[model samples]
Target: MIELSFAGWFQCRLATDPDPYDEPRGVSGYVHAYAGEPDLDRIVSFQPPPFRRTHGRDIGVAVDAVAHEGIAVPDHPLVGATVDLLDAPKFEGRNGVVADDGLEPLYPFHLQVARDDFRAARAVVPADPSFPYAELFAGGVEFGAAEIRKATGEQDLTATWAARVTALRAELADAAEPLRTAIAERLAFLTGNLGADGGGAARFFGALMRYDYVLSSEPEIDDPHGWLDATDHDEPWRASFWLGGWDADVLCGYARGTLRLPDGAGPRRSPRVPRVTDRRP
Candidate 1:
C-alpha cells in the first residue's frame, strides 16, 4: 500500500482512452493528491501527475488496494479519512473489465471522500475572500449569452440581459438581512459556472423564493432538502446547490435566523467584471 501525507486538497478525474480502437485495460480513474498547505493559491500551483500510456492505471490499483483500510492523514483534521473510488451502476460493454456478480465496474472513476471528511476538509480550507464570484464567472457569462441566443433566436443581447442581471442584483440588496446574504451567495454559486445561463439563473432564483416562502409559512419545519425537492429541479442540481459541503447547513441557519455574516464579510463586487469578449464561446 502506498501512503501519502499532505496538507493540500484532492480532486478526481476520470481516465480516457488513448486509442479509440483498443479496450480500457486497468483501474478506472486517478486520485490526484497534491502536497501543500490548504491555501488555494499555493495548492493550485502544485504539479499534477504526468500523462501515462496506462492512464495512471497502476496508481488507481494502488489506491483501490487500500480502499478498505483507507488513507491516513497524520495531524490533519481529516486524519483517518476513508478513501474510495466512485463506482458505476453497472458494467457497460467495456472489454476485459469484469463486474462482480452484482457489483458494477469502476468505469469513468474518480476519487471521492466520505461525506464527513469532505465537510471537514472544506471547513478548514479558508473561504476564498471573494466568496462566490471568481474568474470562473467570466466563462459563465459567455456561456449564458450563447444559451440566451439559442433559446430566444435573438442577436447577442447579453449587454441588455446583463443589465437586467445587474438590476436583479440591486433589487436583492434591499432584501431582509441574512436572507439577503444567503441569497447572494446561493446566486453566486448558481451563476458561477460555464453551464450557467439566464434561464437557469431565473429558475434558481424562483426556487430560492419558494424556499423562503416555505420557511416563512412553516417556521417549524427544518427540512431544506424537502423544500428543494418540491421546487421541481433535478436531484443533481439540487444536490449541487444544497448539499455541496456546508450549503445546506448555511441555508438552514438562515431559515432559523442563526447564520450571521462575519464583520467585513458580505456581498461585494468583484474587482472587475470581465467583458463577454474576455471569454471564448
Candidate 2:
C-alpha cells in the first residue's frame, strides 16, 4: 500500500461513460489518490503548468477495482469517502496516442504513470444516488518539487542528500503551515485516498489534488457482473474534474455527491497499470 507523505490531496476525472457508472440505488464518482505533489513542469519540462485551470473528464477502463482497498465495495451501504480511484485513461491530445473522442478534459487527466497502485480517491454518498459526482473546489497548488523529493525514496539520506532533504522538509513545513490551516478550516484528513466530507463516519473532501495522468480506473465498467445481485448492478453514472499527477491543490467546484454499487469483484480480469517511464516527481 503506497501512501502519501505530503499534506492531503485528491485527483478527479470526468464521467464520460455513464452506462457503467449510473445506477438506480446509487451512483458514485472516481478519484485517483496519491501522495506527494507533482512537478508538472519538471515532468513535462517542455510545457509549463497550464496557466488556465482544468477539470478532468470521464474515463472508461472496465471498472473492476473498488473492493481491494478496504472501502465500501460499492453496492453496499452508501457510506465512507465520497470519491473513488481507477486505472485508465484515453489520451486525445495532439501528442496523445489515443484518438480524440471529442471530450474536453476539464482538468489535467493527461495520463500519469507512477507505481502500479494508481487508483486511490475519496467518494461520498449523496441523498440521491442518481446525481452526478461533485467536483471539489481547490485554491492554489501548495506543493513544490522539493516537497516531492522529501516524500519519495528520492530523498537522499546521505550527508549531502540528508542536507537537501532537511532543507526540503523545512520548506514543506513552512509551506504546509498555511495550507494545513486552510484545510483544517474546511477539510478533513484520512489514511487512504478515501477522504471524507464533514458530517459523520463517512469521509469526503472540500478540496483535492490533480494528476497529469492516472494508472487505475474502470476497465470495462459497462458490462454487468453475475457475482453480485442484479440490484447492485445499476448502470454507472459520471465523475468529472479531479487530479494533478500526485500533487495537492485547493478545490473550486462541487457537484456530484455519492452513490454505491455492490460487494462483488466480477469476472473482469485486472490489467497491468500504466507505467510512467521516468517520472521526475
Candidate 3:
C-alpha cells in the first residue's frame, strides 16, 4: 500500500460495524498518494501508545510497491471499497475495550474513507465581495499579530512575523481567485475585530490547519507549505491520524458564544474558535 496524504483530515474503516471507534476487521489495500505526494514510499499505521511504551508500535500491512488504490482529494469523495491484503496482518496489541481485544486477527479490514461534509467545509468560501472582503481577512490576521507583538513588547519578532505574512500573501497571489478570495474573506472575519465579540481571531487560526496551504504566524507556528486543489465533496480532506495544532474542544463553545479568548499566549491555547461541524442544532 502506498502512503497517502491530502489537504484535510481523512480516516475510515473498511468494516461498517456501526461503532465509529471500532477498528475494521479483515481488509487491505494500497494507497497511491498522501498530502498530494505521488511518489510515496511506505504506508504504515501506528497503534496508540501503550501505557508503558511512548513510541513505535507499528501495525504491519501488506503493501505492494505499486499503488492498488487511489485516495481522492477533498474534491473526490472517497467511496467505500473492499481490498484484499497480501498477508494476514499484525495489529499493535492493546489490553481492553477493543471489540476483538487485538487478539483475534482482523485482516482485510473494510476501508471506507470518511470526512466532514464538504457543504459545511465550503462555508469558508467567500460568497460576497463586500463583507470585509478577503484582503481585510489578511489584514485582520496581521493586525491581531501586531496586537500580540505589542503586548509582548517583541518588536523584532513582530517584524519577522510581518515579513512572513507579506511573503505568504505574495505566495497566495498565485492561487486561484476563489481560494485566495475565500481565504482572505474568512480570515478577515476571523481576525477582523480583535478582542471584540464577533470577530473570529481565534477561529481563523483554528481553521488554519484545515487549509491546503501552510501559514506562518509565530516562530514556533511557522509552516509555509500546502497546495491549491479544487473543491470536491467526495474526496477526503486530511488524514484522520493527523493531529490539529489548535483545540477543537473550544470551538463549539466559542461558536455558541460561550467562550472568551485567553489572556496572554492567546493564539496557541485558543486555536480554533469556529466549529467545523455543522452548527444547525
Candidate 4:
C-alpha cells in the first residue's frame, strides 16, 4: 500500500514475541522498506526491536528487488510495535481496509506471520469492515514503505523519492485545502492583529504541522541540521502549486501523513488520533 499526500505517517513500533532486542542502543527506530509483501505464516508479526531477529520479508514487504519503502524523514525512536494481527483482530486501522480497484479487494494487509499451510498471508489490512481512515494509513505506512523500497530499488532515490514526496504533498493539499486555506486566513488575521512575526513561516509550519499535518511540535526540539535537511528532503511550500508532478505508477494506494487542525495544537501521525472503525455509521 502506498501513502497518499493525505497525511504524513511514520512507523515507530515493533514488538517481538520473545522480547530479545529490548532497549538496544543507537539504532533508534525508523521504518525501512521491505523487498516484497511478506509471507505472514512464516514471519513474525508487528514491529520488532532492532534485535528482534526475523526475516525482512515477514515484516510485510513484497519480496522484490525494486520495492522501495520510505522511512521517517528524521527517524525517531521506536514508540510503537508490530504485534500479532491475531492479538489485534478488532481491526483498529486504515491500510488493509481498502477501497477496491475493481472486484478485487485491496485490503490493507500486514505481514506479521507465515503459516506453513497458507500460501497467501494477509499482507494488506485485515478485512475489517469499519475502521477510520487513520487505521488504514497506520498499517499501510509499514506495508507501503516496504513496497516503496521494492518499487524504487536503487533507482535515483532523490528523483524517485521526490516523486513520492510530491504525490503525498498533492494528496495532502487536496485533503487539507480546507485547512490550508483556513490557516492562511488565520495567519493573515494574526499578522494584522499581532506582529507579522507572530504568524510567519514558523507559525505556518507550526500550525501547518498541527492543523494541516497533525504533527506534535515543541520549540526546543533538536535537529543537528535544520532547514538544510528539509531542503534536501522536505518538499518546498511551492510544491502545492505544482499539482501533477509525481510519477503515477509509484503510488501504491497507501499514504502516510498528518491531520493538521487550526487549533494551534501540534503535528502527529495517523495513529495518534482516535480511529473509529465504523465511519459510515
* Candidate 2 C-alpha lDDT tens digits along 94-160: 2112112222122222222122223223222322234211121222233333433432323321222
Off by over 4 Å in 4: 1-50, 54-213, 224-281
> Global lDDT for candidate 1?
0.23
**Candidate 1 lDDT by residue in tens digits, 14-72:** 22223211222212221111122121111111113233211111221111111112444
Comparing 2 and 4 by TM-score, which wins? Answer: 2
| Model 4 lDDT tens row, 12-44 | 222112222232211232211122312112222
Prediction 4 global C-alpha lDDT: 0.24
Per-model TM values vs. the true structure: 0.16, 0.21, 0.18, 0.19
Sorting all predicted structures by TM-score, with the top scorer first, yields: 2, 4, 3, 1
In model 2, where do residues sit more than 4 Å from their true spots? 1-9, 12-37, 41-76, 88-281
Worst 10 residues of 1 by lDDT: 237-246
On TM-score, the candidate that comes out on top is 2
lDDT of the candidates, in the order given:
0.23, 0.25, 0.23, 0.24
lDDT of 3: 0.23
RMSD of 1: 24.6
Q: Compared with the true structure, what per-residue lDDT tens digits does model 3 show for residues 101-145?
A: 212112222222222321111112222323211211110111233
